[model samples]
Target: MDPRSPPPGDGRLTPADLRLWAVLGLALVFLALAALFLAAPALGALIYGVPAPEGIGRTALRAIGARDAALALYLAGLALFSTRRAVAIVLAASLVIPACDLVLILSAGTAAWWQVALHGVSAGVLALTALWLARRNHSA
Candidate 1:
Protein backbone atom coordinates (compact mmCIF):
# COMPACT_ATOMS: atom_id res chain seq x y z
CA MET A 1 0.00 0.00 0.00
CA ASP A 2 1.14 3.52 -0.68
CA PRO A 3 2.28 5.14 2.58
CA ARG A 4 0.46 8.34 1.64
CA SER A 5 -2.89 6.59 1.33
CA PRO A 6 -5.44 6.52 4.13
CA PRO A 7 -5.41 3.61 6.56
CA PRO A 8 -7.28 0.46 5.55
CA GLY A 9 -11.00 -0.06 6.11
CA ASP A 10 -13.62 2.64 6.79
CA GLY A 11 -12.66 6.27 7.21
CA ARG A 12 -13.34 6.36 10.91
CA LEU A 13 -10.64 8.09 12.93
CA THR A 14 -8.10 6.19 15.02
CA PRO A 15 -7.45 6.84 18.70
CA ALA A 16 -4.61 9.17 17.82
CA ASP A 17 -6.97 11.15 15.63
CA LEU A 18 -9.39 11.42 18.54
CA ARG A 19 -6.59 12.74 20.71
CA LEU A 20 -5.90 15.44 18.15
CA TRP A 21 -9.57 16.30 18.12
CA ALA A 22 -9.51 16.63 21.89
CA VAL A 23 -6.57 18.98 21.62
CA LEU A 24 -8.41 21.05 19.07
CA GLY A 25 -11.45 21.21 21.33
CA LEU A 26 -9.25 22.39 24.17
CA ALA A 27 -7.83 25.07 21.92
CA LEU A 28 -11.31 26.27 21.11
CA VAL A 29 -12.02 26.58 24.80
CA PHE A 30 -8.85 28.57 25.23
CA LEU A 31 -9.93 30.86 22.43
CA ALA A 32 -13.24 31.49 24.14
CA LEU A 33 -11.47 32.27 27.40
CA ALA A 34 -9.20 34.67 25.57
CA ALA A 35 -12.23 36.45 24.20
CA LEU A 36 -13.58 36.70 27.71
CA PHE A 37 -10.32 38.19 28.90
CA LEU A 38 -10.40 40.73 26.12
CA ALA A 39 -13.96 41.68 26.90
CA ALA A 40 -13.46 41.97 30.67
CA PRO A 41 -9.88 42.43 31.71
CA ALA A 42 -10.79 43.32 35.25
CA LEU A 43 -12.73 40.11 35.64
CA GLY A 44 -9.81 38.09 34.37
CA ALA A 45 -7.48 39.86 36.78
CA LEU A 46 -9.85 39.06 39.63
CA ILE A 47 -9.92 35.40 38.69
CA TYR A 48 -6.13 35.27 38.56
CA GLY A 49 -5.81 37.18 41.81
CA VAL A 50 -4.04 40.08 40.17
CA PRO A 51 -4.71 43.65 41.10
CA ALA A 52 -6.58 45.54 38.36
CA PRO A 53 -4.59 48.71 38.16
CA GLU A 54 -6.45 51.53 36.45
CA GLY A 55 -4.94 51.39 32.95
CA ILE A 56 -1.85 49.21 32.86
CA GLY A 57 -3.59 46.11 34.19
CA ARG A 58 -6.35 46.27 31.58
CA THR A 59 -3.84 46.86 28.80
CA ALA A 60 -1.70 43.93 29.88
CA LEU A 61 -4.70 41.63 30.12
CA ARG A 62 -5.82 42.62 26.63
CA ALA A 63 -2.36 41.93 25.29
CA ILE A 64 -2.33 38.51 26.90
CA GLY A 65 -5.78 37.81 25.49
CA ALA A 66 -4.61 38.70 22.00
CA ARG A 67 -1.57 36.47 22.33
CA ASP A 68 -3.60 33.55 23.62
CA ALA A 69 -6.26 33.93 20.94
CA ALA A 70 -3.67 33.90 18.18
CA LEU A 71 -1.90 30.88 19.59
CA ALA A 72 -5.12 28.97 20.06
CA LEU A 73 -6.23 29.76 16.51
CA TYR A 74 -2.92 28.59 15.09
CA LEU A 75 -3.04 25.33 17.02
CA ALA A 76 -6.63 24.69 16.07
CA GLY A 77 -5.85 25.32 12.43
CA LEU A 78 -2.98 22.85 12.55
CA ALA A 79 -5.13 20.18 14.14
CA LEU A 80 -7.94 20.74 11.65
CA PHE A 81 -6.06 21.06 8.38
CA SER A 82 -2.42 20.00 8.73
CA THR A 83 -0.81 16.58 8.54
CA ARG A 84 -0.32 14.66 11.78
CA ARG A 85 3.41 15.39 11.71
CA ALA A 86 2.75 19.07 11.33
CA VAL A 87 0.28 19.06 14.21
CA ALA A 88 2.77 17.24 16.38
CA ILE A 89 5.52 19.72 15.58
CA VAL A 90 3.29 22.70 16.32
CA LEU A 91 2.04 21.12 19.54
CA ALA A 92 5.58 20.60 20.72
CA ALA A 93 6.49 24.17 19.85
CA SER A 94 3.36 25.49 21.60
CA LEU A 95 4.60 24.24 24.98
CA VAL A 96 6.64 27.40 25.34
CA ILE A 97 3.55 29.44 26.22
CA PRO A 98 2.56 27.34 29.19
CA ALA A 99 6.14 27.01 30.34
CA CYS A 100 6.55 30.76 30.29
CA ASP A 101 3.19 31.16 32.02
CA LEU A 102 4.35 28.96 34.88
CA VAL A 103 7.53 30.94 35.26
CA LEU A 104 5.75 34.27 35.11
CA ILE A 105 3.25 33.24 37.74
CA LEU A 106 6.04 32.04 40.00
CA SER A 107 8.08 35.19 39.48
CA ALA A 108 5.18 37.38 40.49
CA GLY A 109 5.70 37.31 44.26
CA THR A 110 2.04 38.00 44.92
CA ALA A 111 0.63 35.24 42.69
CA ALA A 112 -1.19 32.45 44.50
CA TRP A 113 0.29 28.98 44.63
CA TRP A 114 -2.75 27.58 42.84
CA GLN A 115 -2.18 29.90 39.90
CA VAL A 116 1.41 28.76 39.58
CA ALA A 117 0.38 25.16 39.98
CA LEU A 118 -2.26 25.52 37.29
CA HIS A 119 0.30 26.79 34.77
CA GLY A 120 2.73 24.03 35.74
CA VAL A 121 0.06 21.41 35.23
CA SER A 122 -0.91 22.98 31.90
CA ALA A 123 2.71 22.85 30.75
CA GLY A 124 3.03 19.22 31.76
CA VAL A 125 -0.15 18.23 29.95
CA LEU A 126 0.85 20.06 26.76
CA ALA A 127 4.28 18.44 26.86
CA LEU A 128 2.77 14.99 27.30
CA THR A 129 0.26 15.52 24.49
CA ALA A 130 2.95 16.74 22.14
CA LEU A 131 5.14 13.72 22.93
CA TRP A 132 2.24 11.35 22.42
CA LEU A 133 1.34 12.88 19.06
CA ALA A 134 4.93 12.88 17.88
CA ARG A 135 5.45 9.25 18.82
CA ARG A 136 2.19 8.15 17.26
CA ASN A 137 2.94 9.96 14.02
CA HIS A 138 6.41 8.44 13.89
CA SER A 139 5.10 4.92 14.39
CA ALA A 140 2.43 5.24 11.72
Candidate 2:
Protein backbone atom coordinates (compact mmCIF):
# COMPACT_ATOMS: atom_id res chain seq x y z
CA MET A 1 0.00 0.00 0.00
CA ASP A 2 1.11 3.56 -0.68
CA PRO A 3 2.08 5.74 2.29
CA ARG A 4 -0.40 8.33 1.13
CA SER A 5 -3.29 5.92 1.24
CA PRO A 6 -5.82 5.88 4.06
CA PRO A 7 -5.38 3.55 6.99
CA PRO A 8 -6.75 0.03 6.61
CA GLY A 9 -9.74 0.71 8.80
CA ASP A 10 -10.21 4.35 7.99
CA GLY A 11 -13.86 3.90 7.11
CA ARG A 12 -14.74 2.16 10.35
CA LEU A 13 -15.85 3.99 13.48
CA THR A 14 -13.75 3.20 16.54
CA PRO A 15 -14.12 3.78 20.25
CA ALA A 16 -12.38 7.14 19.89
CA ASP A 17 -14.96 8.15 17.35
CA LEU A 18 -17.72 7.31 19.81
CA ARG A 19 -16.01 9.35 22.49
CA LEU A 20 -15.73 12.27 20.15
CA TRP A 21 -19.45 11.97 19.48
CA ALA A 22 -20.07 12.00 23.21
CA VAL A 23 -18.00 15.17 23.50
CA LEU A 24 -20.12 16.77 20.81
CA GLY A 25 -23.21 15.70 22.70
CA LEU A 26 -21.84 17.31 25.84
CA ALA A 27 -21.23 20.49 23.91
CA LEU A 28 -24.87 20.51 22.80
CA VAL A 29 -25.95 19.99 26.39
CA PHE A 30 -23.92 23.01 27.41
CA LEU A 31 -25.56 25.08 24.70
CA ALA A 32 -28.98 24.00 25.89
CA LEU A 33 -28.10 24.87 29.47
CA ALA A 34 -26.89 28.24 28.31
CA ALA A 35 -30.22 28.88 26.63
CA LEU A 36 -32.00 27.86 29.78
CA PHE A 37 -29.93 30.30 31.82
CA LEU A 38 -30.54 33.06 29.33
CA ALA A 39 -34.26 32.45 29.27
CA ALA A 40 -34.75 31.96 33.00
CA PRO A 41 -32.08 33.72 34.94
CA ALA A 42 -34.03 33.59 38.18
CA LEU A 43 -34.51 29.87 37.90
CA GLY A 44 -30.89 29.37 36.97
CA ALA A 45 -29.76 31.38 39.94
CA LEU A 46 -32.06 29.42 42.19
CA ILE A 47 -30.69 26.13 40.94
CA TYR A 48 -27.14 27.28 41.52
CA GLY A 49 -28.15 28.69 44.90
CA VAL A 50 -26.76 32.06 43.94
CA PRO A 51 -28.16 35.20 45.45
CA ALA A 52 -30.47 36.67 42.90
CA PRO A 53 -30.73 40.00 44.55
CA GLU A 54 -33.62 41.85 42.98
CA GLY A 55 -31.69 43.96 40.50
CA ILE A 56 -28.33 42.26 40.08
CA GLY A 57 -29.17 38.58 40.00
CA ARG A 58 -30.75 38.57 36.60
CA THR A 59 -27.91 40.52 35.06
CA ALA A 60 -25.36 38.20 36.55
CA LEU A 61 -27.21 35.15 35.32
CA ARG A 62 -27.41 36.59 31.82
CA ALA A 63 -23.70 37.18 31.82
CA ILE A 64 -23.08 33.65 32.99
CA GLY A 65 -25.36 32.41 30.25
CA ALA A 66 -23.39 34.30 27.63
CA ARG A 67 -20.16 32.90 28.98
CA ASP A 68 -21.48 29.36 28.91
CA ALA A 69 -22.81 29.84 25.42
CA ALA A 70 -19.46 31.10 24.22
CA LEU A 71 -17.73 28.14 25.82
CA ALA A 72 -20.11 25.72 24.18
CA LEU A 73 -19.48 27.32 20.83
CA TYR A 74 -15.75 27.06 21.31
CA LEU A 75 -15.97 23.42 22.26
CA ALA A 76 -18.19 22.70 19.33
CA GLY A 77 -15.86 24.44 16.94
CA LEU A 78 -12.84 22.58 18.29
CA ALA A 79 -14.55 19.23 18.07
CA LEU A 80 -15.83 19.89 14.58
CA PHE A 81 -12.93 21.64 12.95
CA SER A 82 -9.78 20.91 14.88
CA THR A 83 -7.59 17.88 15.40
CA ARG A 84 -7.97 15.46 18.30
CA ARG A 85 -4.91 16.99 19.92
CA ALA A 86 -6.49 20.43 19.94
CA VAL A 87 -9.75 19.11 21.34
CA ALA A 88 -7.89 17.29 24.09
CA ILE A 89 -5.94 20.40 25.00
CA VAL A 90 -9.04 22.54 25.20
CA LEU A 91 -10.97 19.98 27.20
CA ALA A 92 -8.12 19.60 29.63
CA ALA A 93 -7.67 23.34 30.07
CA SER A 94 -11.41 23.86 30.38
CA LEU A 95 -11.37 21.94 33.65
CA VAL A 96 -10.69 25.28 35.33
CA ILE A 97 -14.27 26.37 34.82
CA PRO A 98 -15.76 23.50 36.74
CA ALA A 99 -13.07 23.71 39.38
CA CYS A 100 -13.79 27.38 39.88
CA ASP A 101 -17.49 26.64 39.93
CA LEU A 102 -17.04 24.12 42.68
CA VAL A 103 -14.93 26.52 44.71
CA LEU A 104 -17.26 29.44 44.22
CA ILE A 105 -20.30 27.40 45.18
CA LEU A 106 -18.55 26.13 48.27
CA SER A 107 -17.38 29.59 49.22
CA ALA A 108 -20.86 31.04 48.77
CA GLY A 109 -22.13 28.63 51.44
CA THR A 110 -25.56 28.48 49.86
CA ALA A 111 -25.24 25.67 47.36
CA ALA A 112 -26.48 22.23 48.25
CA TRP A 113 -24.14 19.26 48.49
CA TRP A 114 -25.44 18.05 45.19
CA GLN A 115 -24.39 21.28 43.48
CA VAL A 116 -20.85 20.92 44.70
CA ALA A 117 -20.79 17.29 43.73
CA LEU A 118 -22.02 18.16 40.26
CA HIS A 119 -19.18 20.56 39.67
CA GLY A 120 -16.62 18.17 41.05
CA VAL A 121 -17.93 15.34 38.96
CA SER A 122 -18.01 17.46 35.86
CA ALA A 123 -14.40 18.41 36.34
CA GLY A 124 -13.37 14.83 36.82
CA VAL A 125 -15.14 13.67 33.73
CA LEU A 126 -13.67 16.42 31.62
CA ALA A 127 -10.22 15.60 32.89
CA LEU A 128 -10.56 11.92 32.21
CA THR A 129 -11.98 12.47 28.77
CA ALA A 130 -9.18 14.84 27.89
CA LEU A 131 -6.55 12.39 29.00
CA TRP A 132 -8.20 9.56 27.13
CA LEU A 133 -8.39 11.57 23.94
CA ALA A 134 -4.81 12.70 24.22
CA ARG A 135 -3.52 9.20 24.79
CA ARG A 136 -5.58 7.79 21.97
CA ASN A 137 -4.40 10.48 19.59
CA HIS A 138 -0.80 9.94 20.60
CA SER A 139 -1.09 6.19 20.09
CA ALA A 140 -2.78 6.66 16.74
Candidate 3:
Protein backbone atom coordinates (compact mmCIF):
# COMPACT_ATOMS: atom_id res chain seq x y z
CA MET A 1 0.00 0.00 0.00
CA ASP A 2 1.25 3.45 -0.80
CA PRO A 3 1.83 5.55 2.31
CA ARG A 4 0.13 8.47 0.61
CA SER A 5 -3.03 6.52 -0.07
CA PRO A 6 -5.70 5.21 2.30
CA PRO A 7 -6.13 1.47 2.72
CA PRO A 8 -7.89 -0.31 -0.12
CA GLY A 9 -11.18 -0.57 1.75
CA ASP A 10 -10.96 2.89 3.22
CA GLY A 11 -11.88 6.01 1.34
CA ARG A 12 -9.89 9.20 1.17
CA LEU A 13 -12.09 10.95 3.70
CA THR A 14 -14.54 10.29 6.48
CA PRO A 15 -17.18 12.88 5.77
CA ALA A 16 -19.09 12.16 8.95
CA ASP A 17 -16.03 13.09 10.95
CA LEU A 18 -15.43 16.06 8.71
CA ARG A 19 -19.01 17.23 9.11
CA LEU A 20 -18.88 16.91 12.87
CA TRP A 21 -15.64 18.83 12.93
CA ALA A 22 -17.24 21.58 10.90
CA VAL A 23 -20.11 21.79 13.36
CA LEU A 24 -17.71 21.97 16.26
CA GLY A 25 -15.64 24.62 14.58
CA LEU A 26 -18.65 26.84 13.96
CA ALA A 27 -20.19 26.18 17.35
CA LEU A 28 -17.01 26.96 19.23
CA VAL A 29 -16.72 30.31 17.53
CA PHE A 30 -20.25 31.17 18.52
CA LEU A 31 -19.73 30.03 22.09
CA ALA A 32 -16.56 32.05 22.42
CA LEU A 33 -18.28 35.13 21.06
CA ALA A 34 -21.13 34.59 23.47
CA ALA A 35 -18.75 34.50 26.39
CA LEU A 36 -16.88 37.54 25.21
CA PHE A 37 -19.99 39.60 24.60
CA LEU A 38 -21.56 38.63 27.89
CA ALA A 39 -18.47 38.94 30.04
CA ALA A 40 -16.58 41.77 28.39
CA PRO A 41 -18.83 44.05 26.43
CA ALA A 42 -16.14 46.66 25.80
CA LEU A 43 -13.71 44.11 24.45
CA GLY A 44 -16.41 42.45 22.40
CA ALA A 45 -17.45 45.77 20.94
CA LEU A 46 -13.87 46.32 19.83
CA ILE A 47 -14.01 43.01 17.95
CA TYR A 48 -16.81 44.47 15.81
CA GLY A 49 -15.35 47.99 15.83
CA VAL A 50 -18.43 49.34 17.54
CA PRO A 51 -18.22 52.06 20.14
CA ALA A 52 -18.68 50.62 23.59
CA PRO A 53 -21.73 52.00 25.29
CA GLU A 54 -21.93 53.04 28.91
CA GLY A 55 -25.38 52.24 30.34
CA ILE A 56 -28.14 50.33 28.58
CA GLY A 57 -25.69 49.40 25.87
CA ARG A 58 -24.10 46.92 28.17
CA THR A 59 -27.41 45.17 28.41
CA ALA A 60 -27.68 45.18 24.65
CA LEU A 61 -24.29 43.57 24.35
CA ARG A 62 -25.30 40.89 26.80
CA ALA A 63 -28.43 40.27 24.78
CA ILE A 64 -26.32 39.78 21.71
CA GLY A 65 -24.22 37.32 23.65
CA ALA A 66 -27.32 35.47 24.70
CA ARG A 67 -28.40 35.16 21.09
CA ASP A 68 -25.00 33.80 20.11
CA ALA A 69 -25.21 31.28 22.88
CA ALA A 70 -28.63 30.19 21.66
CA LEU A 71 -27.38 29.80 18.14
CA ALA A 72 -24.44 27.74 19.31
CA LEU A 73 -26.69 25.45 21.26
CA TYR A 74 -29.02 25.03 18.31
CA LEU A 75 -26.14 24.08 16.07
CA ALA A 76 -25.07 21.49 18.56
CA GLY A 77 -28.55 20.02 18.60
CA LEU A 78 -28.72 19.95 14.83
CA ALA A 79 -25.42 18.15 14.63
CA LEU A 80 -26.52 15.51 17.09
CA PHE A 81 -30.13 14.92 16.09
CA SER A 82 -30.46 16.09 12.50
CA THR A 83 -29.19 15.24 9.03
CA ARG A 84 -26.31 17.10 7.41
CA ARG A 85 -28.70 18.59 4.87
CA ALA A 86 -30.87 19.85 7.67
CA VAL A 87 -27.89 21.45 9.29
CA ALA A 88 -26.93 22.96 5.98
CA ILE A 89 -30.33 24.53 5.61
CA VAL A 90 -30.06 26.08 9.03
CA LEU A 91 -26.58 27.30 8.27
CA ALA A 92 -27.75 28.87 5.03
CA ALA A 93 -30.64 30.58 6.76
CA SER A 94 -28.32 31.89 9.44
CA LEU A 95 -26.25 33.84 6.91
CA VAL A 96 -28.63 36.74 7.24
CA ILE A 97 -27.43 37.50 10.75
CA PRO A 98 -23.85 37.98 9.65
CA ALA A 99 -24.97 39.98 6.66
CA CYS A 100 -26.86 42.24 8.99
CA ASP A 101 -23.82 42.52 11.19
CA LEU A 102 -21.78 43.67 8.23
CA VAL A 103 -24.34 46.33 7.45
CA LEU A 104 -24.53 47.48 11.06
CA ILE A 105 -20.77 47.70 11.35
CA LEU A 106 -20.51 49.60 8.12
CA SER A 107 -23.18 52.07 9.16
CA ALA A 108 -21.48 52.69 12.49
CA GLY A 109 -18.60 54.32 10.59
CA THR A 110 -16.13 53.59 13.38
CA ALA A 111 -15.36 50.12 12.11
CA ALA A 112 -12.03 49.70 10.37
CA TRP A 113 -11.64 47.89 7.10
CA TRP A 114 -10.60 44.74 8.91
CA GLN A 115 -13.71 44.79 11.04
CA VAL A 116 -15.92 45.11 8.01
CA ALA A 117 -13.98 42.37 6.29
CA LEU A 118 -14.42 40.05 9.23
CA HIS A 119 -18.18 40.04 8.90
CA GLY A 120 -17.98 39.63 5.15
CA VAL A 121 -15.58 36.72 5.49
CA SER A 122 -17.73 35.10 8.12
CA ALA A 123 -20.77 35.23 5.87
CA GLY A 124 -18.77 33.89 2.97
CA VAL A 125 -17.44 30.97 4.95
CA LEU A 126 -20.89 30.18 6.27
CA ALA A 127 -22.39 30.25 2.81
CA LEU A 128 -19.67 28.02 1.45
CA THR A 129 -19.95 25.48 4.22
CA ALA A 130 -23.70 25.34 3.93
CA LEU A 131 -23.50 24.77 0.23
CA TRP A 132 -20.92 22.05 0.68
CA LEU A 133 -23.00 20.22 3.24
CA ALA A 134 -26.16 20.49 1.24
CA ARG A 135 -24.45 19.23 -1.88
CA ARG A 136 -22.99 16.33 0.02
CA ASN A 137 -26.54 15.31 0.97
CA HIS A 138 -25.69 13.02 3.83
CA SER A 139 -28.96 12.08 5.45
CA ALA A 140 -28.95 9.75 8.42
Cα RMSD of all models vs. native, in order, equals: 4.4, 4.7, 8.6
**Residue 15, candidate 1: alpha-carbon lDDT:** 47
lDDT of 3 by residue, 1-140 (tens): 78865334323224455776787689889999999999999998988779999999899888889988988988777777666666777889999988889888888889988888888888998898787766644443
* Top model number, TM-score: 3
Off by over 4 Å in 2: 1-16, 137-140
Q: What is the descending lDDT order?
A: 3, 2, 1
Q: Which ranges of candidate 1 are over 4 A from the true structure?
A: 1-16, 137-140
Sorted by TM-score (best first), the order is 3, 2, 1
Tell me which residue pairs clash in candidate 2: none
Greater lDDT among 1 and 3 belongs to: 3
Q: For candidate 3, give the lDDT.
A: 0.80
Predicted structure 2, TM vs. truth = 0.81
For residue 68, model 1's alpha carbon misses the true position, in angstroms, by 1.1
Q: For candidate 2, write residues 25-123 as lDDT tens digits.
A: 778877987897899887777766676656765887888788789878887787776666677778898899888887787889989877778788889
TM-score of each: 0.78, 0.81, 0.84
Candidate-wise lDDT, in order? 0.70, 0.74, 0.80
Model 1 vs truth, CA RMSD: 4.4
